[model samples]
Target: MTSDAPAAADKRPRKADGDRLSKLARHKHIISQLTAAPTLRASELAAVLGVSGETIRRDLMELQEQKLINRTYGGASRPFALEPALTDRKAIMIAEREAMAAVIADLILPNEVLMLGAGATTFHIARRLASRAHDITVITHDYAIAAALAVNPSIRVLCCPGRYHPNEGYVFGTQTIANINSYEANRAIVSATGISARGANDADDEAGAIYGAMAKRAAEAILVADHSKFDQRALTVFAHWTDIDRLVTDRQPEGALATALRAAGTEIIVAQL
Candidate 1:
């Protein structure tokens, strides 16, 4: 079966969605378009970018957060501030991530087998689960996640084999994907760099490949993403909305992304902060 947005290894592109550009690329395009006009409606950007109106709105929100654009009613205009690097938007939202982690930890049952992906938000989940969840076996490629879960004697931590990424502090490659595929988990809990109507995405290809493998190998897949990721697209579309059983987030997704998630039978769990 053809996946909605396959990993880079698969080399099979989803021809249906025209707005397949990464978030950073989209930001650049949006800025350029705004430069050409004083203001542009979300629908105009959506038509030009081949994405939904909701996605354009989300893009505008992200841009506004970065101080790159001024959001008007139904549209956006150029702002005076220069855009920052995409990866620079981090180290914040601690309270929100921890809240989502707490919610996920509550949902985790004893003796459950889980596949945990690497990311800041997922790391928070690991920390929360380590303190509360017992008798669960966690299989992960992230060294930090393994270390956090290892503190709980009741929980068993299994590490995957792969080349280590010094900066990201995780292991990812074909080996990691192969290792994840070797296990059958009760639930695969993964984090995303972005989540849109298309699916859960990651900025890194190797990490995304591992996430996709874990999702496919598990009985159920739970995606964890913060509000910042809402309506954002990334380099790798790891899992489609239909592949995800639940989405744990700090805020509820609105508009088109919300409708798409509902249509895909994805249950949204908003973490109370």
Candidate 2:
């Protein structure tokens, strides 16, 4: 009787926990989890949220209808995506970003010029270079990246001239593109909001334009992104796989993306955690 009572108590709905959360709050959590992982099973989500399996299924159904997630066999996956604000993104995947940054920084040689695009992962690379790289020039449209690279006295940082995007903390427009075109770089290190068989992509067209310009102007284009970006399709494909020289990421891309990279002859460098 005592054992049965304890088991019953354990099975009771956590009314003080997940039950108190609103549907909107649960949806937000579901999205957050999906962002950090490749896929989520319905059973795991039910256990974590302390909700009934049916409730979780209903939530997944609604999110799928809204195109927020891709429903899988008893699971969910990241959709062809949209990203949050830059500030919000900066807070996510810190360790993965830092690991990728380290690998990218090591690939850079002294006295080389690099074109950096605007994104949270690239920002982490900028910070890594500031501490480790030497005698390098970094040209970027992101004011924050320029400031980060400036901390290294040996690195020369140039900010592009263009209209400032208040929310993104970067410059973008005709001037930015022209300026990027004028400088030939040893390498371009950029981040994408998504990477699918279609190639590297961004959620914002203006940001995509900047990344595209950088890739064209540089001798080698290196894309630094973490695993969560895998299979995500975004608003614009900035650089085709053939245009990219190397990909620095925390995980090896599988499925169609791996096939595309192999076909395009782009090198994949998986950073050690």
- Residue pairs with clashing backbones, model 2: none
lDDT of 2 by residue, 118-188 (tens): 98999999999999999999999999999999988999998899999999899999999999999999999
Evaluated at residue 105, the lDDT of candidate 1 is 92
Candidate number with greatest lDDT:
2
User: Which consecutive 10 residues in model 1 have the weakest lDDT in total?
Assistant: 80-89
lDDT, residue 140, candidate 1: 93
Instruction: Please give the lDDT score for candidate 2.
Output: 0.90
Model 2 stretches astray by more than 4 angstroms: 1-66, 69-79
lDDT for each candidate structure: 0.84, 0.90
Query: Which candidate comes out best when scored by TM-score?
Result: 2
